[model samples]
Target chain A: MVRVDGKGSGALVEIRSLDKKYRRGGEEIDVLRGLNLDVDAGEFIAFMGPSGSGKTTLLNLIGGLDTPTSGAVRIGGDEISRLSGRKLAAWRSRHIGFIFQMYNLIPVLTAFQNVQLPLLLTNLSKAERRKHVEAALDLVGLSDRMRHYPRQLSGGQEQRVAIARAIVADPTILLCDEPTGDLDRAAGDEILDIISRLSKEYKKTIFLVTHDPIAAKRAGTLLHLDKGTLLECTADGLFACKPEDAGK
Target chain B: MAIPLEYNVRSVFIRWPSTLVAVLGIAGTVAVFVVMLAMAQGFQAMLIGGGSRDNAIVLRGGADSEMMSAITLDQVRVIADAPGVARSASGDPLVSAEVVVVGAFPLLATGSDANVQIRGLSPIVLEVRPNARIVEGRFFQPGLTELVVGRNVSGTYAGFKLGSTVEFGGGRWTVVGVFDAGGSSYDSEVWCDAVVLNQVFKRPENIFQSATARLASPESFQAFKDAATSDPRLTVDVFRETAFYAEQSRMVSTIIRVLGFIVAIVMGVGAVFAALNTMYSAVASRSAEIATLKALGFSPASVVASFVAESTVIALAGGAVGVLASLPFNGFTTGTMNWSSFSYLAFAFRVTPEIVASGLVFSLLMGIVGGLPPALRAARLPIIVALREL
Candidate 1:
């Protein structure tokens, strides 16, 4: 197990004593409690947990989609958890790119248009935006499929399009929740290899949530979340955990 | 940032069934609204167009219309001598004493009996109403049972065609001519010699229903009215013919307006509900799509604007169709009873530009009302929850 000996002062993402509570029918459920973590830039972290283990919730909090009930989440020196909805949305556009398991590419738009979505928020001219979208599609190996719609592509191709959309704006971080959950083994491996290249070459800080231990092994840092706290894992990650204690 | 317009447009085309339902509902409502308003406009135009600003009608005091007034020949002569009366080329005051009576005639289209205005006009009538010109044959001669059918009523009533004989006023009056009255209400009347009509109807030849006189100018109507009413020998009310006809049109116009509004409101409510149902369904079906847009950093206001624009486009399409559907009724002539004169008045439907504009504005308003709530719902939906939706 790799453990830090000091506070991460120059870390890209800093979480301190974070708590998240959800009220359901007058009952307050603590989804996350007193979570502390520091992630450096260009680190590829994989979070493996069973359902209701708060992995997605923790990712949401870091992406500024949800506010923590207590404590602070600082990204690039800004307290994102304290931002309002509009400010957070602006921040997300500038810094965070999300890829969902369902590959939520707008069904009505072609692959090129879908990748161009986030760039619309920028002051980029039409030609500049087209250049960036083309480069992103090229990176994801979807340059030839730019004119096809989501329904026209297979699950792997749709997820590749979603990836192109995420990186077209050159965001500071990528938050992918089950990016390959719907794909078969070969498709999933291809997606993971592309994601690894983004981290190594583009230096984009990526946080991936997964249920597969093989997927977790591809990350530079592997951590397991249970109940409301994260546990460190060895270099082999899930292989080091007891079978029931790993993904469960 | 706003979502691209193509997203909303393609969504509309992709789900054309619901969009079509909304479009047709708005179209039907606008069609009914435009046609109803056209009816009122046509009726009012025909009546108000009958009068000239440079002329005055002298009626017995307290009579609102010519049919309700009875003035003696001596009173008509006194009115002719009024200070502001215009003189003709022969230096005679331009005054015409006319008698009006309602005759029962069968409608050509329905064969049902209807009360038609029969006006017994003196020789000076054509000069006083210069807009009335013989279009088919010459005017009737004095002391003869000859009639001139108006252009609007020429073939609308049985036996009113040119050269046809119809019995009225205890005589067989021959239809000798057809006159065009510049699309005025006078185009709905039959004209004959006053003396001949008085004799056949057994009324005194010295008595006439009203007298029309040309004023020196439009500005001289008040002076003429003052002169006529101030004469002690004549008990008459003088009105600028334009003002009198305007007042005569008020009752029917108001009825038509009220009826049109009532029908439009009822149908408008249904159209709005249909729009609401269609938009709500669109929002429900597009929950995931909307969530993805929001997650992509599109502002809530932009989402709202996009959806509202889609709804407006649908409504405007419907409005255009409605306008086109109502155009064919323009100038389609029909007749209805004039409550003031108790005579059948013929007019055509007038689908004016103003009514078309109003119909479009009305549909636009419906689109906004129907779209706002569902758009807000779509905007306020929690992104994560909606993302999970099917």
Candidate 2:
């Protein structure tokens, strides 16, 4: 078994004094303000907050899908927050996978083809690609349903397929936004269990944003946010604290 | 990396109604383009196919058509005896001094009167124009009020059937035969003895409209032209038969071609607009999907290419349908007034492979023009905003 050390000195994702702002009709709205984080490799961290708390924005910045207004996001020591446009896209494809609340699988593709999408960026031969896709689907326990399209699968199954697609390329990190927000309690539990297994068994670094406490409890560490500031969860209650204050 | 092409194809199928709208619009445009060009092709073929490079025609100088030319009998003889003129088995020069006139004929289909060409020629016409053959009956006998009508003229006009008599030129003439001229412009004329026609029409006794002669070989035409023109007695212009027919087809064919292009362009604009609207709607409906693809690391250029490819496939399918829709008109006979000859000329619609190819090329151009803006818009969509859209 691979050992997962949450406080390890080797940090895979490091964000320093990050800020993100949006302008709406001359109003500069600060979405993230002076946020700093360090997530070690193989750590599963979840952020829980109310609407407008900038959880998704922070997730976007870490995944290289968006540039911060200032400061830097470094993944494996490379400053990715400065990358823009096509360069950022290439970086994200190689290093990050995203799972949305709606299970955003391409409607036209079957589950196997959906999982095979990320592998196309690689130079793998067709046989090798097929092998990778099959393995990913089998890992998600959807081996019997490879040919099913998104419309044909239940919500839980679709989320599972999304998970399979996310990890098919073995990306450095998985960024999920409310991955089970659209599911029932039973299906949501199943999704969280699968995510937990991926974190524990496969040593995948995961950053998840969710409103449900049950979903947040699956992560190795839980952080809460209010008014664009992150707070660590403690046994007593959630309070504004630095990354070092966690596990105190 | 890009989305697989099959994704775009399946998306098109998933939204078939909008796809069909663009397809039918482009199909209609291509059909109009193909049919119009076919008309010009058919007309050009009719005139050009009748001409032979080894034959030459002599018309009065400055006269643009045979109907406007008048050659005196002396000039005709001089042209017949010109150097390089071919000789028949009987040692006679193979030349025909022909007279051209026009008479109104009642159309069998429309009952409206249309001007038909009446050509008066000598017996040597058979030697000079070897493509003309009597299909139903014998050729007209000389010095009688007998005439032969072309197959197209016989089929389109009333009272021109064999064994029938028609009143014209202040007298009645018998339709002795029906001749086919191998799809040439000659198929739109009536032929009778030149001497009888001049006498009946009250033209000067020794004057004919033109003289056509077979040269010893195609190479002899330049010598023949120099010799015929050097004589001070003859004020005439000379041309090889093929060159003359091409000149005759120039005006009408140009008009049809220009009009076809204009109509196709106007209709093509409409098609482009239709395609643009369809693609915009496609992008709008697939906004979240596009965002997902972007989030998955597909370059914006790939998305643009995917959409353009889909539009092109739709346009090509429409072009094929347009070409197929035009097949029924192929070889279908119709008649129009020849601008140069000032007489009715019958021809078939020709749908050549080149015409079909041009139609497809035109459709492809429309697809590109129509697909571009929407594709650009799709590529430039803000990923975060697009993802948030329902």
Candidate 3:
């Protein structure tokens, strides 16, 4: 998708000339090469590619979960390419919110506690954290379900709770790795609504990586990737298609 | 920092097999620990209980225990006037000069025989030891060639029962009574009159093996020591009854304590290895969960602490069970050879609070030591790789 509104000009995420490789049993396996991209604040974009296309590898690099062999990744002003271990954890907690396809909510915690996870890094009191969690759940319209556990919720409901968790810390960016990949169509739509609202209502910069074209179609800009390359930029606002797009 | 207990509990639930294996390993360690501690307790109790605080043992000037000492009748008479020696209201000496000997015999129980100490005592002896009781018969006529066997010395060999005759040192002695001496050293003694024993074992400088005297007060103790030691006429040493028993207690307790520590160390090492195995399994299995937690911003320290705490909980559970397992052994009486007496010394297993506490701390330490490596591995794992394990 081409930039239409030119609204989010300042970059929230910037990745340059990133490359990664692994040395296994005395052989080198290259995973990513010369990857370059930028996403400004409040933009929703999708990363689509084949298996091992390095969508996850690139996302891992951008999320500061892994260090790139070569490149710089700046998220909300901090270059996190060289941050190690606990420092990386600290940086990740403050800067990025991740929504996984399986919705990796800690099973031991209740929905409220799951949302409160990232905020544990903040200096907020329990009451303060609770208030923020309530607001986040409220924004996703799951305020009444704050006490439910992950196992107690339906797939869409769990995803919505995950979204609430992602936004609870008031993070700068939302990174979804195939967010709807694990759900049925109806539940996926409900999750997309919540995710779309995160961008539209809270102005969170969103990056969704997925291969299902219908899932990709929901994004404002689609960066179609086949072999780790940005092959196409579809010109459409996030799910800008008519209501019929939800069916197809 | 004291981690909230919920984290530990949740961690156990997440890694149940690892936790169970750790608990079971710790359980085995604890079981052995409890049994050993109980044995020590029983042995210690027997040794400590076998002595009296009011009665003092007077040994030859150079000797340590009655089994090794012999004193003349003159020394006994001299020690009776020692300042702390309690006197009867009838103006008689409250202490008794006794003859102690170990008669060799084959045992009926365990088929392992050892010498049994026989003491020749007088009228004042019963008054000095309140635990002395004639359970089966009246007191023996002291001047007669009659004898009484303490209950512990009875029923272990032929002619050991009440009214059974036995010949010792090629002399005939009639068993006239059986007594119970409330589980002290007196319980192990077969009794006869000093006059009768001196006549039978006659070299009749009227020598006895040792003297046991009752003291009246703490203040008069030094005077008694002076009476025994300062006078060249009395070649002997005097100790407070309490002090003497306390000394006797150390010989047995020190051995029990040292053996207990050695056993605990060995079992602790085994438990540590088990805990290490369980923790590694836990960390390996929960890598994805850990990665997710890391992604959620929990510090590696918190994660490490949670696992260690969980392992400790398992270990503590095992230790608690061990303490309980040891309880039945408490007061379970058994006897072993006392090298000093060349006789079977009886004792009960004691399961004390200090012992249990030390065991628990040991288990906890084992868990912590074992959990550390896996915890570090978990902490250092890349968040991406961990999450990918899901």
Q: Is candidate 1 or candidate 3 better by TM-score?
A: 1
Candidate 2 DockQ, CA atoms = 0.60
Clash total of candidate 3: 10
Error of 1 at A26 (Å): 5.7
Each prediction's Cα lDDT score?
A: 0.87, 0.88, 0.75
The candidate that wins on lDDT is: 2
**Span of 10 residues, lowest total lDDT, candidate 1 chain B:** B381-390
For candidate 3, write residues A1-248 as lDDT tens digits: 23322223347777777778877899977777666677778878877667888888877877878898887777777889978777987888888899998888777677887888788788898899889999989987888988888889988888888888888998888889988988999999888888887778778788888867777666766664445554433235333333223223
Native-referenced DockQ of model 3: 0.42
The digit string of per-residue lDDT tens for model 3 on B116-204 reads 77778876778777678889876778788788887877766556787777888667888888888676655667888887877777646
After superposition on all CA atoms, what RMSD does each candidate show versus the true structure?
Answer: 3.4, 3.5, 4.3
Off by over 4 Å in 1: A1-7, A24-27, A233-248, B58-62, B70-93, B204-207, B214-240
In the order shown, the candidates' DockQ scores are: 0.55, 0.60, 0.42
Pairs that clash in candidate 3: A1-A233, A1-A234, A1-A235, A220-A237, A220-A238, B41-B349, B41-B350, B42-B348, B42-B349, B42-B350
lDDT of 1 by residue, B183-232 (tens): 88999999988878999999998999999998888988888888888889
What's the C-alpha lDDT at position B129 in model 3?
72
lDDT of 3: 0.75
Model number with the top TM-score: 2
The TM-score between candidate 3 and the true structure equals 0.85
